[model samples]
Target chain A: MKVALVQDTPRLGDVATNLEKTVELLEEAAHRGADLALLPELFLTGYRLGDLVPEVALRLDRPGPEIERLAAVSRRIPFAVGLVEESSHHLYYNVAAWFEGGELRHVHRKCYLPTYGMFREGMDFARGDRIRTFPTPFGRAGLLICEDAWHPSAATLLALEGATLVFVLSASPLRGLGVGRHNLSIDTWVQLLTTLARFHGFPVCYVNRTGFEDGLGFGGGSFATDAAGNLLASARDIDPELLLVDVPVDRTRDMRFAYPLLRDERPELVHRELGRILGRTEETP
Target chain B: MSAPVPLPMDAPELTRQLEAFLHEEITKAGFSRAVVGVSGGLDSAVVLLLAARALGPENVLALRMPHRDSSPESLAHADLVIEKAGCPAETLEVTAPVEAAREVLGIEDPLRRGNLAARVRMIFLYDRAMARRALVVGTSNKTELLLGYSTRWGDGAYDLDPVGDLYKCQVRQLGEHLGVPREVLGKPPSADLWPGQTDEAELGFTYDDADRLLWLVVDRRVPPAEAIEQLGLERDLGRTILERMRRTQFKRALPLVCKVQARTIGIDFRYPRDWGL
Candidate 1:
């Protein structure tokens, strides 16, 4: 299956323009023969929303014109895009919602919102408390926002749920200088995402936003990897790009059978161990 | 600390990022062109060159606004940069306005005179920017910004800053790697306000020393006593840099607003400068 990994600059707090741009990009992706497309975290509203969160947020339950437009495009080519989702309870969440067959299939509110050091997501948005993989035309898949992939447990949970392909969306900032031309943050992410895909025997598609907002820049170096962790497609640094890659489902199947690491995994024992570590099972046994 | 631990230098990558920053911030602010005061020093030179690369040499307007007491070499080095970058430039002397203010106000102190000269240059740059429809970019580095060495609303004014986060030593290192002229990099650092004015002489510490001390205190977040010990610096020297940073806190922030309303700007009323952009 052909996947379009979009790394584009979202105009901060201007949902109208970004929504228009996203529609155009989706049409372009579909024209290019992509089976699916994935956009960066907060792809519609932009990251660093501060007080403008509510102003730009889309109500999922009510299905505004923007959400309806996205659903229409998803019918052309199944796609996932991130946005500031205003829940029915009137709380905001940084979310990635997948659209397919003219319907909202799955939505993942970011499980981990970084609260410190150049980030204040926790202060702005409510945390998502659940993780699940949903059925898609491509097969079982899961979505993760930027910080969610930083924790290994999140990916492990997705793997345990039998996700074959995972899309990790991010608005990661451009920072740090080491030996390479790319900043440290971009380099670190490629390594981390590649390793997780290899361990889980699943294809991981990572899409990050580009351009600066209030002096904080999000570097665009979106990439994708095969099940065996070989980089399939890589985009440029600091520019908007539509990186396309082919997901070899046969390789995923081969790797999962050849590796068989997940086949023998024991989540029940792991849960009990976690309960013991938390001191909840000390006297029960 | 420990000879500053040799700050990392990646000339190509840092150049790429800063240039990209200029393109993003400038165009986002609704201008395709930029104007920067070319002081002939490393900081301004770097800013000008990077701006040229990002916005194209034709788009950047280089201004050399020098006072009467300003060193001749300032103009000469600035010419060299303009020629090398191939950007359009104008040499507007601020001496007339500065002298007018000096005589009318009967300003006797050299310090006050220098401050007047800096602000006068700002007038020329901003006026030209307004006429040319270009945004002014600042040249102050992190060390000078932290120490509040710039005159408020004078050399400190700009629509955007590209070098504010980089330290003086890092700026010098980056300038060298990007093929900045040796004469510009080799000379002692100066503000060129007066004939004999040098930044080190006024600050009482070289950029090397200050950078090492700052890396420990600011970047590493070490306690002053511990950082001073690691740098093998005199307690007084380290203390002065720290004190200067502390004293200049006001320069780094917006004007204070006392709250009477439910929300006040910069206190409770918070939004990004890029809000709605």
Candidate 2:
């Protein structure tokens, strides 16, 4: 399956504008012949929602016009867009939703809401507690928001549950320069995505947003890696661009068979050791 | 005593990021143009070039506000930057307003007099920015800002600062990469508040020495007791650097509001600076 990494710039707290731009970029992705397209985290409503959360968030249970437009776009090319999801109650979540053939297939709410340093996610978003893989038109897939993929266990759980492809959506901010060739934030992400892909034997498609939000610039180095952690396609710089990555979805079987690392697994030892360390052996079955 | 090495940087990468920063910030603020004070110093020259590139040269208004005692080369270097950037340029004589303020306050000390001059320049820039529908771009580098070496509301007041994160040495590195005139790059760093005032002489430390210290103390978060020995710094310079950073912490932030409401503005009722933008 050919996945297009949509490195888009969403205006802060402007849903109408973001929805329009997202549709236009999705068209671009389809024109480039991508079967699946991945947008950055919070692509519909922007990343720093703060007090504007209620104003910009959408209820996905009864998807709004903003989501309906994307679902319409998905009739031809299945795509995933980052969003701020308003729950049935007043609570909100950082979410990524998959739309295929005018149906919402799966949704992944971000679990790790970073609250330190330049981030204030914990103050605004209710943390997600679920990690699972779902059936997609392309294949069984897993979706992860920016910080959720930072934890290895998030992706590993999905792999164990039978996901052949993983899409990591991000809105990572740009920071730390004057030391390396790349911005420190972008550099770290490249390494992290590669490790996740190579270890899980899945082609990882990463799409991060670009542009400045309140004087904070985001790293826009959206890219993909093979199952062996080799770079397939990359962005030009920290500006808005579209990157299309060809994923050999069916070949993941060959990859896993060649390595056979996941086959010789010992999760009981881990669950029991983790249980013993935390003094909670009750869940160690 | 340790002689601090000049900081190194990826100049091309910083320029790309900084330009994007200016473009998005200025656009978000609802302005397409910028107003900046161009003293013939390295920091302002670099800022001028960056602003010019971010918003095309025609969009940037480079103003030269010089006092009577300001060095002739200051205006000459300012001219060099304006010419090189090919941006819109203006010159202002700030001597009258500054002298008037100094006289009314009965100020005799050079430092106080210098501060008056700095504030006077700020007034002209802000007023011009208002008339031109532009935002004032700051030229204060990280080294000067960390040391609190600028007038609180004078050179420090700006709508946005593209080069604020850059230390003096890093600014120089970027300036060189952007092709700032050699004469401007080679000149001694000065505020030009008076005839012979220089930044290093007034601060009692070189930027090379202070920049590495700032990085260690602030960026790396090294303890003073440990850093002094690690860098082999002469004891007093290290002490004064930390003191300046601590004392001037108030200048870097908004004025503190008393906690009367359950959720005060700065303390708790926090929203991003780019709210609804």
DockQ of 2: 0.68
Best by lDDT: 1
TM-score of each: 0.95, 0.96
Across residues A158-257, which tens digit of lDDT does each residue of candidate 2 receive? 8888887888999888777734646467778889988988788887889989987877787888998877677888885578889888876766787799
- Across B1-277, the per-residue lDDT of candidate 2 in tens digits comes to 5755545677888888898888889987799999989998889889999999999999999999988888998899899989998998999899899888888999999889988888888999999999999999999889888878899899999989988888888899899999899998997888876788888888887887788888887777888877766788888988887788899888888889999878898897766788767
Write down the worst ten-residue block by lDDT for model 1 chain B: B1-10
Model 1's DockQ score: 0.66
Query: Could you tell me the TM-score of candidate 2?
Result: 0.96
| lDDT per residue (tens digit) for residues B159-186 in model 1 | 8998898889889888887677889999
Best model per TM-score:
2
Q: What TM-score does each prediction get for chain A alone?
A: 0.96, 0.94
